[model samples]
Target chain A: MDPQKTGFDYSTFNPSYFQHLEQRIKDLDALGIQADLILFHPYDSWGFARMGQAMDKHYIQYIVARLASYKNIWWSLANEYDLMAQLGQKPLSAWDFIGKTVHQEDPSGHLLSIHNFYDPPVHKGTTKNWFDYTKPWITHLSIQSDNVFFVPKWLDDFQKPIIFDECRYEGNIEFGWGDNSAKGMVDSFYRIVLRGGYATHGETYIDKPNTTRPIWWAHGGILRGESQKRITYLKQLLATNGFNYVNPMAVQGPHWELAVGESPDKQHVFAYIGDNQPEFEIFDFLPKDNIYSAQVIDTWNMTSTKLNERIDKNHYFHIPRKPYQAILLTKIN
Target chain B: MDPQKTGFDYSTFNPSYFQHLEQRIKDLDALGIQADLILFHPYDSWGFARMGQAMDKHYIQYIVARLASYKNIWWSLANEYDLMAQLGQKPLSAWDFIGKTVHQEDPSGHLLSIHNFYDPPVHKGTTKNWFDYTKPWITHLSIQSDNVFFVPKWLDDFQKPIIFDECRYEGNIEFGWGDNSAKGMVDSFYRIVLRGGYATHGETYIDKPNTTRPIWWAHGGILRGESQKRITYLKQLLATNGFNYVNPMAVQGPHWELAVGESPDKQHVFAYIGDNQPEFEIFDFLPKDNIYSAQVIDTWNMTSTKLNERIDKNHYFHIPRKPYQAILLTKIN
Candidate 1:
């Protein structure tokens, strides 16, 4: 069981670890949740992160063989792969080998990705610090950035399911990565989802009196933040509308400041104006021939109100001039 | 005077225009205000923006000769000079010539700068869209960007007085540049000023019912936004504390998420936690020898409360988990 022992010693491998993972995956599957497992992380003081390439590949193979059969499994090679590489604990070649081993060994062909640590400098909607997500073994992008505005550009470049796995957390913790307010977290979630990407939520509220209790971000515990109900509302709205994917609207008017997304069929459009509270917005991009039933949604309050008057391309939809307001447009004919 | 006319004909020069400008400058001087005179702009239906290089130079000479005597005048060569250049109405050389002409004609040597339209791509804290403020004739950097986070870098690069003349406006207008909320405007001002720069406030609240009234941003009429009082509070706070310039703190702990600034003498520090609501923060970066009195400021509500306990390097400051809160530390011993 010693991590310092590099070569794969099957005789010494623990069966209880596999059993725990299998049970967890089964429970998550029953709950209709995807279990995004991190195979490596730099927050370890042990020698496991420093395991040689051969041992790493063997470990990946063993995990894939044991847990890849679960329908809910998503393979995250590392929490912060860049940090591991920077620390010289693992090289880029080792990550590639691990990814290839996981891909080859997994019969289920589950979602495979690696999370990044270096937040690439975004200039004119371009970045270079991402772990070449274009690689053959990488199935999708697992990003760690606060700039969800780049989701549209990433969708264009990668053409894959991009998940901002870590856009900080909703909490009152002291660290920068874990102290975002509930409203900020909800705003980020809507921004990411409406721009044709996905976001993962985490909570890091420090437990008072009994400060030793595990936080929801690191260890499973009670959800203390208020973003969960709003996120559920967003999910229900999208699912009820039968919208599987919504790309950013192509027009360049309100879309410059608003996160406006249209379904591939072009029948449903959702625009989230996060902070701006314009009194009325003209949707000149909507087809002139189509009539739309507009609904103003209060994202924070989890309420949707249907407008009495139908709207066309020529008309402006009057809004209540409030923050965290979203407008949903459904074509009537 | 016809805007289409090219050369500066003394016979046709309008004395009334000069008289009006003189009166306005005098009025502003009496009110202890600096009149930032924009000599050229692209929002023109007339041919004045299309004036030839000679006429542009002549106009600059005339304006500078007439207005330079006033102590409260700042020569902004053009509003969005880049837009004028992009329109092919004026070239870069023409701007350089105009800037040089203004510098030569203004014997009083008032503050001289040019605004830009191109929102530069900021990557790793570097931008290229700014007009060359390095030129000796330009006294300061007049910027038109919404990102006040880059003020520290801009201060480092330009080493000139930086004023974000248009970080959007405080209003509910339809335009993106004029639709920021009052809280957002106040946040931008603190972010700019804390990083050792300045910000100018503009309001674009559309007057309901009386829709034809001039907005404060373009044509000054009445200020309707709630940000003005908060900005005045900020100005009074800085002035009362005798803080001329406070650069962003060099250390990178809480400063990563918080806008923390320190006076050049290192005796005073101001930290603005814009959206984060951390319950407490540990300031280990402060000098261990200095004893300081700390005050928690509710920036939006315009209230300040002093903490009874003096803090040195070893203590953690307990804070209420709230948004738009700022902390001020002043040396007492």
Candidate 2:
């Protein structure tokens, strides 16, 4: 990418760029971080994004040849592919060609996806559903959405794994996408997870003037945000007691936000209350003999407290006086 | 409401209830708060919501007879009418009757609306758009939505004045609908406003155990939250320079969230940037002869610093490193 910046000159292909990427991946592996590699992006000051189809094919092949062996690598065909089209640079067919190229050439079968963003004038009338999720080359849907409400529909529409790759970052940077608070970031993480999808974490902290370097979002560097720690806590919670195995159940009635993830036998129930709701009665839809133990989870504070000793029939729970609260119910054997 | 809690008993209606209501209206007038009176709500422990059609008509007529004279009153047919139906007490026909009765009986012709909520099982497959904005009895759409993204669509769908009556209260309450933070509340308020809709503010802070009383959202004692002052600031911003009069311009291309409000002559341009957005060149879209003076409005902190002396074409202004930041452009002759 560095050498080809002047133009898509094949003569400028230096092995050092791949060496640096390989080294970075190894470092990321050390920290147990999965690297979602973007092969082409319009964030280019370089001419790499405007390369001809042949050059694009050459670059895609080169990237796969160098980095396909890594277990943590994911192939994001392009970052904001829609933005590129909006800028009148690359068209969808180019992305299709590049994606097919990556899918065919990568023998290790690293997960393939393409990042998308809203075209400007984000008002409601101008907004369009731009992504083709059913593409055979796409392994999963990677999205950057302004709202989380539409995620469920996308989940149902595509019937594939959905990843909230960009739900705004946690930082005080000069961009809206990177200025979300740690609490907001974690809240989105839980919201997506509760709704039967996944979300990724990024940080973009701006330090004292001229001291800001190696932003965690763009430039690979040390993590300096609070969300990662809380996300670690969430990851721990998901892995424990086989909690990660459950999928969100079909909810009916007025409490539309009461997103519940239940195990097959209905033994474990994780209910996420997104915002503050008034007092309501929660019916135990579990088996007749099952006595459910419910605990209040303060998601932001990462604390779990026992709410009730046993709930048999309908139980009245005064939801916490806070946002991002959840009720974790594990049935007593 | 307290005395008639047993049922819509006409015998229980006393002169003292009207006297108390008149005094409350006077008190609300003193505080400059327009009263949104609920004719019926599902929160009643009393049988008011389950009244027969005849009793419902009687109650509606009584309410109109007593309170319709107040100029500040807005009739809310019921709080979460669909919720009442889901509770198996009141049906939609009952709500339709109540709404029509309120519409016909009230001589003052105060704004009439009905509140709605989401049904549970938060997935997109189950989410239903239940509000009939086109109803003849309805004055405007009164909505309680979890996501603010739908506001623009609602504005378009109904083509009537939209009020986000309950877009989640700002508090740490155990309910997701009432536990939003002051910052989140203000952000939503601005978001709704920029998108050509109105939002209301409420608070529900629960103090230490057993000491909590008079929730600002329910009981309405005193203003205990921070959003009111910020909302006042927003109201002031809207009032100043007639900024509230402009509708958001149609945005095209990559910057989907550039919510703009401009004067009729295209002289005064108000652009709000929510969250941290990556850099984009802000072009001077006004007339050629006019010299535009730009200032950065820090919506959260209430600061407006002079940004540019004059912006012509392709102006590059780095947005503030914060959420809810705005760039206010005024034409200086």
DockQ of each: 0.40, 0.21
Question: What does candidate 1's lDDT look like per residue over A52-160, in tens digits?
Answer: 8777777777788788778899999998887777787778667788888888999888899999874321222235556889889899999887777767777888988
Model 2: lDDT of residue B146: 52
- Cα lDDT of model 1 overall? 0.79
Tell me the docking grade of candidate 1: acceptable
Candidate 1's residue-wise lDDT over B53-88, tens digit each?
777777777778888888899999899887787787
- Candidate 1 deviant stretches above 4 angstroms: A1-12, A92-94, A118-126, A208-210, A250-257, B1-12, B118-126, B208-210, B254-256
Best prediction by TM-score: 1
Name the 10 consecutive residues with the lowest summed lDDT in model 2 chain A: A118-127
Instruction: Please report, in order, the local distance difference test score of every candidate based on alpha carbons.
Output: 0.79, 0.71
Q: Evaluate model 2 with DockQ and give the value.
A: 0.21
List, residue by residue over A1-333, the lDDT tens digit for candidate 2: 353456556634789878998998999888988999888787877767777788788878888988999998999988888888777668876877888899999998889999887432352222254567798888899988646545556677788888888887887643446667777788788777766788888887766323446577667567777888888887787777466545665344444446666665567777777554434435444456667888888777889999855765454545544567777778886
TM-score of each: 0.91, 0.71
True contacts kept of each: 0.38, 0.26
